[model samples]
Target: MLFCDPSMLPCYRSVQCIGYLSVKIHRFMLYTFTFIYSLGV
Candidate 1:
């Protein structure tokens, strides 16, 4: 079993953080598109 080193934790964490941020951004874009489409009616 490979134990994660403290130094590597930040790098791993940053990648996870970016993934989470991108998910949020993706949702925001979808939400905005839906909202705009609804306004067209």
Candidate 2:
């Protein structure tokens, strides 16, 4: 789901900037959502 989920655009972009590097797609998405949720954003 690399940048495919519109609702996750901001989170995805933020994660990208943080540098996922060569991480797996599912792992990246999971990390992004967890990070966002933790921020209560």
Candidate 3:
């Protein structure tokens, strides 16, 4: 809906995908760090 124009749809979708992947990667990194710290402790 925000990108109603056809020309903008691809750009909007790509941005959305990138945002989602970044969030997932960030969470994964956080969890990995926490797990490693716990093991070290």
For TM-score, the strongest prediction is 3
Model 2 ranges off by over 4 Å: 1-23
- TM-scores of the candidates are 0.71, 0.42, 0.75
Q: Between 1 and 3, whose lDDT is larger?
A: 3
Clashing pairs in 2: none
Give the CA lDDT, 0 to 100, for residue 6 in model 2.
47
Which lDDT values do the candidates have, in the order given? Answer: 0.75, 0.68, 0.77
User: Which candidate comes out best when scored by lDDT?
Assistant: 3
Better of 2 and 3 by TM-score: 3
Residue-level lDDT tens digits of model 2 in 1-41: 44434466687767764554446666888999999999996
lDDT-superior candidate, 2 or 3: 3
What's the lDDT of the predicted structure labeled candidate 1?
0.75
Residue range 1-41, candidate 3, lDDT tens digits: 33334555688877876777788899999999999999999
* C-alpha lDDT (0 to 100) for residue 27 of candidate 3: 95
For candidate 3, list the clashing residue pairs, or say none.
none
